[model samples]
Structures are given as C-alpha cells and as structure tokens.
Target: MSLIDQVLARAAADPGVRGVILTGSRARGTQTARSDFDVTVVVAEQARPWRHSTRTGTLDEVVCTVEALADTSVHWRRYSFRGAKVLLDRLSGGIAELVDRQATLTAEEAVPLARANLDAYINQLYRCVKSRRDGLADAALLDEQESLPWLLETVFALHGRLRPYNKYLRWELENFPLPDPWSVVLMPDQVRLAPLCLFPAVESLARRRGHADVLDGWGSDIELIRAFAGAAGP
Candidate 1:
C-alpha cells in the first residue's frame, strides 16, 4: 500500500479522528517533485491539539477540533482550503460541507468587498497615472505594482469567488476563465506585459454591478486616468 493509504488506514482506526482532508498543492494537482502531502485531521472539540509527520517530512499533518475548524476565518483560510479533498468524513458529510463553506463567498459578502477593492485599485491606478504625467517613472511603476492585488481581489469578488494566491492565480484563471473581456486581459502573460489592459473591462463590470457610485466618487480624475492609460498602451 502507498504511504497515503497506510496513513488513512491508521486514521480510520482512531476513534477520536472525525475526518481527514487532503489539501495544498497535492490536493490541487499542482504539486512539484518537492511537494509533500498536506493533511488535516479533525477531531472532537474537546480533543487536545496534536500532529503527525513522516521521518522524511513527506507528510505534513495538522490536527484540529470541529469547533476550531468551524471558527477558522475565511480571510485567513480561504485559499488554503480551496479545492480541498475529503479522504474520510466520520461526520456523515459535515466536514465536506465545512470545506465547501470555506471555499465559497456569498453575494452578500462579495458585493461590499468588491466595492472596497475597486476603490483601492482605482486609487492606485490614478496615482500611477499622475506619476507618469509628472515623469516619475519609478513612482508610477511602484503604484502599478501596488494596484495589482487590489485589482485581482476586485475581479474575484465581483464573481463571488476568493482571490487565489499569486502562485495559483494563473492556474485558476486557466482552469476557470473570467467572463468575456475580463478573461483575455487577466492571462498571466498579458498581465505581466501590462496589467492596465483590464482597466476598461473592470470599469464596465464595476459600473454594471452597481459600483458606479464608487467610480463616480473619483469624478473626472478616473476619465483622465483611463485616457492616459489607453494612450500608454501595452
């Protein structure tokens, strides 16, 4: 039997273990030669914290109680738990449900988040444009870099999804392309060349999604930024 099978068999024999979940690169099928098995072992709320590992460090085990698992913050664990796989669930599917909850974002949660990220992203883009107008190339580049994460967060929240980790961003986009015009500009290569390529699409999406107020908050400044960015094509 493989090491994973042996580990699962042992976990099955432990009465305290409520479930076993496979996570990290191995679970996402993005592992490299150096990747290890990332496992989460769930137990009763009263159970003491513990861990398990192999001598060669091929396995990384984390032990948590049901209460702790449920209490985990979505912001902190969302990317980590995304695409997780349940190897065993003695809770009759409760564990699987928890994993799903950790991976998802409801519309109610997404809307306000999208607004906030859009505000931040536009703020950075405006700064980038102003710096360029002033001939401050270094400052403009810094502002451009600063805006990327916010831009990504805004896009993901618009779709009620989590912003993936940078390492997985390309993989996620390739597997699940965004809607229409947004998809083309977000490709890794395109983004590397010029992230501003998505500005027009993002602006349209934000306006259609009831974020016109946020954009309007910037007034004519945004129009100038848009014009300047367009003129400065990738």
Candidate 2:
C-alpha cells in the first residue's frame, strides 16, 4: 500500500477518531507535486484540547485532536502537513463524514466597510464600462470583479449569522460577481473567483446590511450596483 494509505490505516486503530476528510487540491483530485495533505480529525468530545506532535515518514506529518463526534456545532481538529497523500482514516469507531462548505465562519463587516466595498465594485464596474464606452473596448475590470454576489450574500447570511459559501452558492444560485461590464469575458459561465478577487465584495455586501434585515433591506443599493454594472452596450 502507499504511504498515505498506511497512515490512514494507522489512524483507524484509535477508537476515538470518528472520521477523516481530505480537502484542498488533493480531495478535488487536482493535487500537484507541491501540494500537501489537509486532514480533519473528528473526535467524540470538543472539550478535549490537544498538543501537537510530529512523526517521521516519507511525508511530513502532524496530528491534532478535538472531540464530540456527530455533533453539528463543534469544529473538527485540523491537521496540515507537507505530504502528497491521504495517510489514513483508521477510526475503529467509524469513518468521519466530509462536509464541503466554504465561507464557513466569517463575521459580517461593518456598515462603512460594506458600503465601501459596494461603492468600490460599482465604481470599478463603471470605470470599465466608461472606458469601454470611451473606446477602450479591450479594457476589463480584472480585479475584485468576481465577488459581487457572495458579498451581497454576506448581508443575507448575517440576517441569520451564517457564512454563505460561494462554492455551495454556485451549486444553488446563478449569482453575479461584484461585476464589471468586462465580467462577460472574464467570467463566462463561471462562478466564484479567487478569494482575493472576492474580498471587497464580500466585505461590502455584508456591510450594507449593517445588522439590518439584509434580505428585506439593501434593495436600492443592489439595484444601483446592477445598473452601473450593466450599462456597457454591445
């Protein structure tokens, strides 16, 4: 068996470990030579704190522990080390289920920051459209252009204190970026860009709500942003 498989087998020896999840590029099967394994160790109790440890191997290894298996509210133990594989999930108890959610735990932004992000994305869209209309048809708003909806969703999420995951949103909502007119070219049939690109929109969208009813509020700003973004003509 491979080294990854062996490690997973070893982890299974412990009865307390409930599951193991492999995320990042490897779980997506897009791992490169430089990619390392990210494993979450799920245990039966959250109150148990952990000390870190390193073990020798062809792969760099580290282990952390946390508890309360099968509980929804407790966060899992996170282990990240350099190695290109799934070492093991050997919990004699059972296999830990994997939950793939992004934007899992973000606090909402303040009103000022949210407003700034909204204005910034709208203004960026306007600049691109204005430039294209001015005949720089080749100009595109390439930066911070893809985070529009998730940003907006932050407000929507804050109505309930949930961090809406963009990856999951893509599966459900046909959302737009903090869109510029050039978004058509940069994001034709795509959802979610780099977190860096989505940064401002994420901050602003949540901030606009400012602890208000995000769903029931903020319609005007959303409309205004859309109008500015869509002004580019064919």
What C-alpha lDDT do the candidate models reach, one value each? Answer: 0.83, 0.41
User: Each prediction's TM-score against the native?
Assistant: 0.89, 0.42
Model 1, C-alpha of 224: deviation from truth (Å): 2.8
Model 1 deviation from the true structure expressed as Cα RMSD, one decimal place: 2.4
The window of 10 residues in a row where model 2 has the poorest summed lDDT is 75-84
lDDT string, candidate 1, 1-234, tens digits: 986798799889989889989998999999999998888888885546444544355888888888767764548567778889999999999999888887888788899889999999999999988998899999988988888989889998998888888888777787778787666776666775564656887888888888999999998999877987788675
In model 2, the Cα lDDT at residue 186 comes to: 27
Cα error of candidate 2 at position 75, Å: 9.1
Model 2, 100-161: lDDT tens digits are: 22213334323433444445444454454455446665554443353454344333343332
**How many backbone clashes are present in model 1?**
0
Clash pairs (backbone) in predicted model 1: none
